[model samples]
Target: MAPDDIDATLGAAWHDDSPWDLLTRLCAFDDRLGGGPGERHAADLVADELDSLSLDPRIEPFGMQRWTRGHTAFSVHPSDERSREFEAVALPYSPAADLRAPLVDVGHGTPAEVEAAAVEGAIAVASTDSPAGERHTHRMEKLGHAVAAGARGFVFHNHVRGQLPPTGALQFGHEAPIPGVGVSHETGAWLREYAAEDEEASLRVDATTDDGESRNVVAKLGPESDAEVLVLAHYDSHDVGEGALDNGCGVAVALAATRLLTEFDLDSQVQVAAVGCEELGLLGSAALADSLDLDRVKAVVNVDGAGRFRNLRALTHTSEAMTAVAERVAEESGQPIATAEGPHPYSDHWPFLRRGIPALQLHSRTPGGGGEWDRGFTHTRADTRDKVDPRNLRTHAMLTALLVRDLSTTDPDRVDTDALRETLREAGAEPGMRAAEVWPPDWD
Candidate 1:
């Protein structure tokens, strides 16, 4: 595309002012956690917005073992007796354990290492590589493995270079068998060194779970359609943050897309899913995926971090045809689009990918610079609307609308998984996994 063409595309995006309105409306909900009233109210607001666009909304309900943090407290007592108390917060979904256990220094508690040490009834402290994409998943997995081997709880020390101390809620599977938390690099280093020197460290933790109703606010355009396209974004935020950028931006963009598509009156069927409780293990997405028929799904486009336009990254675990459609839309919108082959387990797309449905993840980044800033704001209180660039949000909304329109009208058989796989591998993904095995006589 010519420079003038690019400018025009961007200009067109900026001309539409719906994205800003949508952002303001969605942020009004203050939605957090999967099943809380905030989530339910947020869903209602999104559904109302879709209804105003002349779309009929559907609510698909499923039960999830919901979790919430309650009165978490942890502290370390020094053997010197004169040392001040070092404090820590317990991770979400951690089991309540009030025992004053003897602390054991387990270096990066991998499965094999934990087994070799036979750590039981002792708190394990390990160093984390860094807090970046998927690093938390690795740490949590290690913590779970250790808990299964009889460890009491786990603590993580930050290892990121020249970074601020790690803060915010430590989250894991709601059903995880053990408790976990993240600590400052300084504190973690102290614990490790103290253990190495044969000084005793004392640890304690407490937490609980409560029952609640989580919801997915869905709005549909076109009724009784054989093929459907689902557009998704989670409205929930982590404990300490307002979730303006982590997902509030994506939710706003999706809402804007819904408005544009409705105004255009496209023939294809579309659904906007403003999911709740995503931060708590993708509960809303998991429920929606299970409730829907995979065979009827034409495609899923998940919008996340869409309000920042400086750097754009679009990852897909969808068919080649869908990826092509995304690239074309990006081209037309005059946004730089980079593709990746991924079934990003952390996002709402995981449920669709597991069902063998085509899915995509869209994100924005800082221009030119690739540093901690691009990935750091999430889960922290720093994620707020001030970081949002309205121009970027508008571009994302336009691209999303175009992609959904095209996919909803296309045939599922035209999608090419093989080509998509090659594209993804070149983008840094391992070859796609073989289709998952199906079981149970009643499976869909």
Candidate 2:
């Protein structure tokens, strides 16, 4: 296609309504959890869209252990006659238990704090906010610390305001050992005050866990090639909020890019993956990675969190070649692209990255801060459709389309597992990886 023709196509991509329509439809479902009703609905819609483009998409089912949230409550006891109950939500994969124990508030709930507090046979209270100059502590890490300290239960207090209780997974690959719940910052403050006065708190959580199934949606654009560029985004989300920001935008961006790219022939194959079960874990992406012949995969562009801001940011982990490509695309498009140099194994791209495949994680830029950012809306009930803007969504899709076009022509240098491990150590990401128990056991 000529440069002028390419320009016209991209401009037309801005006016596309399929992406926004899909986003709205996805947000309407409440069961987007892996293998849940929402996931099935989302997969059907994506497959239908791909069929319209003659992509012949298929739904690949995978086994996953899923959980359902139930009743959870936290109460503070100043005395036998005085008690206060606060709003809370159970963390995913937390064991279903109804037990009461003394609560001890451990600020930020780091390993050291858990060690310092008398947490044996008690419920440990931890803040979700990380310390200054330190990385945000993973929910699993905090739960692990509490469990190691002999704590019978765990409670997470959000740092941001607005009565939003933060919820996240406390298990990595297995079910959590104890019950875990999240509370708002205001509730946390009450717990802290009671702790100062030498008071006790009680927590009771009743959740349900069972073996379940989920799937990954796969569609192909352009002709078959030896190497394909993998485009991935999760359609599953937490059950609390509409999940509009955590991943609804991600699906929209992927659809928009795929819709536009299908209009013209590409240099290589593009496998559009709308994965499921990311909220529980990267189950869908993991299944796809396990099934793929790695040699046939050239590069991966995983959009987990995009369209929340006007500009798109790429986290290029130890991939100098991909960094150069992103830079070139940014220059040519006259669009500012933010770049972060680090290794993060929490998203869908980690499975591919660990295997030495060059990958990019697309997300919106957050303010510079180790803590104190206004992220209370994430993982909470406040993440609604209003938070997403159409303009940002369209711009991000155009940028993604350009990236797909640019990355298809280049073959990335593969970094071996040892080199990848070394890169993580040098980047100071090893500790977090170890804490999350995602570090390759063989590497150690």
Off by over 4 Å in 1: 1-18, 21-31, 81-83, 102-119, 126-137, 158-173, 198-206, 222-224, 265-267, 366-374, 412-444
TM-score of each model, paired residue for residue: 0.80, 0.95
Winner by lDDT: 2
What does candidate 2's lDDT look like per residue over 1-444, in tens digits?
667888999888778887778889989998587767888898898888788888889889999887888888788887756788899999988888877777788888877788899989988889888677766667777777788889998999888888999988887645788989999989899888777676777777787778888889898888778999999999888888998888999999988888888876688999999998887878899999999998899899999888876678888877887788789889999998878766678889988988889889888854453232335377898888888888888898888988889888788787566877887787565665676678878777
What are the Cα lDDT values of the candidates? Answer: 0.64, 0.83
Quote model 1's TM-score: 0.80
Window of ten residues with lowest summed lDDT in model 1: 431-440
- Backbone clashes (count) for model 1: 3
lDDT of 2: 0.83
